[model samples]
Target chain A: AQSVTQPDIHITVSEGASLELRCNYSYGATPYLFWYVQSPGQGLQLLLKYFSGDTLVQGIKGFEAEFKRSQSTFNLRKPSVHWSDAAEYFCAVGRGSNYKLTFGKGTLLTVNP
Target chain B: DVKVTQSSRYLVKRTGEKVFLECVQDMDHENMFWYRQDPGLGLRLIYFSYDVKMKEKGDIPEGYSVSREKKERFSLILESASTNQTSMYLCASSSHDRLIPYEQYFGPGTRLTVT
Candidate 1:
């Protein structure tokens, strides 16, 4: 079975500061990874996805993720986070032919002024 | 753009009452899923349907049932609502296209409260 682990339960960063959210996955073979963000009382929106090729994948809202095969990690990073970037982020792993995904516990991000 | 819409945004139902959550997708997606989101738990799938009249049990489907009579609509049912089931219900749909098969588009979600 595939599983995702997000070590940080909550993260707080000031505006204009760079941010990185760690995500680790346990899969037997090559895994499809994704990052999703959810604002207060809103549904989840896909931040980015890693399917194949280029280790560095860019996503909407100036977010990017690096798929490191050796470390089994797909961490999300942003050069400078705005106050609007504060939200809950989730990491998910997709395996096999099925379209199902196993998601992590989630990391709540707070952007401080 | 794929759009998924749920029937309700906020629902308050009494315990033991039957609850129905409806979801519809604009795109002709082959898969639709129902999930519950909690504080610590990101999202747990309860049921999913790949096609019309075809349904599959997801990770947590013990207290849930689903119906998919139409290709664009999926319904999740709670036979008897319990306080434990009170949470944010999310509906999502994804295409089976080989090019981009794994991305799921989600609805705004329905917050259900059982009292």
Candidate 2:
């Protein structure tokens, strides 16, 4: 079985500060990882994805993630965050056999001034 | 850009009522998925179809059914709407594999309330 775990339930960051949301997964084969962001009352938008090759991938809105195979982790990071960046972040691991995905519980990001 | 549309932004239904939430994708992607989002639970897949008229159970499939009669449309059904089933329902579609740009495209979502 495949599963995703996000250690943090909630995180608070000051505006213009760097942010990192941790994510780990348990899967058998090579993993397909993705990060999604959701605002209140809005659907999820893809922030980034890592399929193969590069361990690090860049995404929209100044987000990036690194896929560490040995650690079974794919953590999302941002050099600097804006108030608009305050939203829920989700990390998911795609099921190798069925192409389905398993998502973490999500990390709620609160940006402060 | 690929587009995915859900039929309703909000719905209110009584218990035991039959409810249908519709979703449509314009990209003719080979795979479509239905998911329910709850606070602190992230998103739980209800069901998905790889092709028209074909469906597969997801992580949480009980009390739910789905229809995909056309390539572009997928409908999720709740035979007996219950209060516990109330949540924000999301629909998404993607290409079959990475070769075809398989990132899932999501709809704005239907917030269903069963009372």
iRMS of each prediction: 0.8, 1.7
Identify the CAPRI category of the predicted complex in candidate 1: high
What are the runs in model 2 whose C-alpha is more than 4 Å off? B100-102
Residue A24 accuracy (lDDT) in model 1: 96
Give a tens-digit lDDT track for model 1, residues B1-115.
7789999999999999999999999999999999999999889999988899999899999989999999999999999999999999999999899888678999999999999
Cα deviation at B16, candidate 1, in Å, is: 0.8
TM for candidate 2 is 0.97
Clashing pairs in 2: none
lDDT of 2 by residue, A1-113 (tens): 88999999999999999999999999888888889999988888999998898899999998999999989989999998899999999998888756577889999999999
The superposed Cα distance between candidate 1 and the true structure at residue A61, in angstroms, equals 0.5
Give lDDT: candidate 1, residue A43: 94
> Which numbered prediction scores highest in DockQ against the true structure?
1
- What are the per-residue Cα lDDT tens digits for candidate 2 across B3-97? 99999999999999999999999997889999999998889999989999999999899999999999999999999999999999999998876
